[model samples]
Target chain A: MNTTRRSFLKLMGVSAVGLSLGQLGFDLAEAQAYASKLKIEGAKEVGSVCPFCSVCCQIIAYVRNGKLVSTEGDPDFPVNEGALCAKGAALFSMYTNPHRLTKPLYRAPFSDKWVEKDWDWTLNQIARRVKDTRDKDMVLKNEKGQTVNRVDTLFMMGTSHASNEECAVIHQAIRSLGMVQMDHQARV
Target chain B: MPKAFLVDTTRCTACRGCQLACKEWHDLPANATKQRGSHQNPPDLNPNNLKIVRFNERMTKEGVVVWNFFPDQCRHCITPVCVDVADMAVPGAMIKDKKTGAVLATEKSAKLSPADAKAVAEACPYNIPRIDPKTKRITKCDMCFDRVSAGMQPICVKTCPTGTMVFGEREEVLAVAQKRLAFAKERFPKAHLVDMEDVSVIYLLAEEKEHYYEYAGFM
Candidate 1:
């Protein structure tokens, strides 16, 4: 084996405890008890992409017993090089955020509270609103008598959370609805 | 062969990735915090937060507004006074790991009285080691001994986006600190390493300690 001095020193560092607080006449039994097994010891690492911002840094998700044990940035990735920003670092919490909306919430026009609604009901309401707004505000022609085919009042706001493919589909869907004023949340 | 940390403050952008990563790795619960006009949340280190990115802002005599970020944690001192103080009250309360030179607080620290616990915390030069109100035990950064034992870097060091924190063998880390200090001195003439000789975790401060934190270094 090609063991250099540096590698040998690292091996020595890992394998031996030259001096401890115990040798200094302090009991380390309690501190030893504090050294529990690593949480990701037996976990399986699965590579995934971070779902934040334009820089989709690769992440290693540690899964144990089919559940996510932990997550961190992948060291091999060139973009982030194992480094994560504040939002990327908090990926675990973002996954397990209790306040995250899993179900659609709907609040009536005059209501003060939002009640849980099914996806079908939510989608139907959205479609109806979009159609009504498009019908009311569609500008088919300008003063120059040229077809514009645009809706003035309707606007589409894209989310940074969406993947590239999803953004493309969203763009097409909004364009088909004659929406012109489109902006992305990521741009802000 | 002991491990050490080089915290290059010049590279830190106050993103708080290290702080959040520490909390995530330890599975520590979040503290309820409000906007205190500064990005430094929860104010200071507590039971839940073993590490925090301290933010300090001051205007120089030249009318330049300078903002500094200090990622504060237990220095894991070479001759930890916290261990001495804690050992006086509770023998097994704190221990220094031989191989990594990591100063760790144990569950046995709960045996200490409020006065003894406060004394242990007060003994730290960097003002680390907070006593948990509920557990009545000392709490501070443990240098991620479990992770280090598994041949992995500490969460704070691993998650630092700005390359502010570097963890490795003592000699190599000291070299890195010195190199970073020399580079920082070119830009900030007052650049220096804070108490490098006394602690396993060395911080390369680009400016005076007064512009960082009151307890940024030993008195």
Candidate 2:
């Protein structure tokens, strides 16, 4: 039998306590209590909503020393009533994770590398691409001679992160450009 | 009065909100993991992860596959075996809080030798404790002692989208567990509460213990 030193130490540890339990007549209720320190005791709470889905569960982000300490569901919100899904519960990581992108990244048509681009440059690039695609693909009319304004080459994908007012504004802008291929990222 | 938890497995959708919430509360770092052909990640319990949702699939006699999810963590047993084991090697390494019945691994656990720490972890019947290779301190769920002591619910229970986890005074939680068990029995005749008398975390399993995890319960 390989008693090896590790298992032997473990065996002695277990049996030593087994004998001690009988000696002390240990009762859990009488065990020594400890006063624990709360992790968010002095942190500032900032209320926010989960951006993962339509539920939009409210959350309280605890920040201490200008850094996020903890995050949890907000009990006051009626939509989720303090309940959150996996993605919502993991909101803290999204905010603090090193891997998360803090700036816009752009890749050229055939480039094998991604380049960090400023917000102004990225927005201008998107606007320029949209204008070019719309001008090249906008259809004037259908085969039956009905006036139809549509851009087949351009597709617009929106996200649940947008508010109702923002969605309305975005939808109007996309429609005005005659982009027919549009979809919302959220189903529920 | 000591506090307790009532986990109704029938209500768990396996969304893993509680698992992630635990990590968020503890501020544990993320694990660099690859897909194991299942949604379960990080593979196994470690010093970094104090809680995890275990996924298992079993084939029923009806020829349909039944899935089971057990949100696994330390049970905080009424008489914790790990504490006893730790006390033998290093006196203050482990402690059981009288007010909340929360068995905790103290910072003094770093004093235990590698052999002694492994023994302390190995003594746990539920196999929960994880020893850090660097610090050699045994670690596991502390019942969110800091949160509960501050009059806030455990983050895991608070973030559960489904009413799968419940925490309250021990008696109140036990009553809730019994009521939930009765309700679940109608759908799953085998529904029962796991280790209610022995541990603070009372699990209302919807199926036999085998369906969940091999260590889901002890007689």
- Chain A TM-score for candidate 2 is 0.71
B180 Cα displacement, candidate 1 (Å):
0.9
What lDDT tens digits, residue by residue, belong to model 1 across residues A1-188?
89854355346545434444355233556655565467876678788888878778888898999999889888878888788888888888877889988999988989999999999999999989988998998889999999999998987888876778998999999899898898887687
**Candidate 1 C-alpha RMSD relative to the actual structure:** 4.6
| lDDT, candidate 2, B14-67, per-residue tens | 999988888888878888899788877767788778998989887989999998
lDDT of each: 0.86, 0.82
Model 1: lDDT of residue B211: 89
Where does model 1 exceed 4 Å of error?
Answer: A1-28, A46-58, A131-148, A160-166
Candidate 2 residue pairs in backbone clash: none
Q: Which pairs clash in model 1?
A: none
**What are the per-candidate TM-scores when only chain A is compared?**
0.69, 0.71
For lDDT, the strongest prediction is 1
Off by over 4 Å in 2: A1-36, A138-150
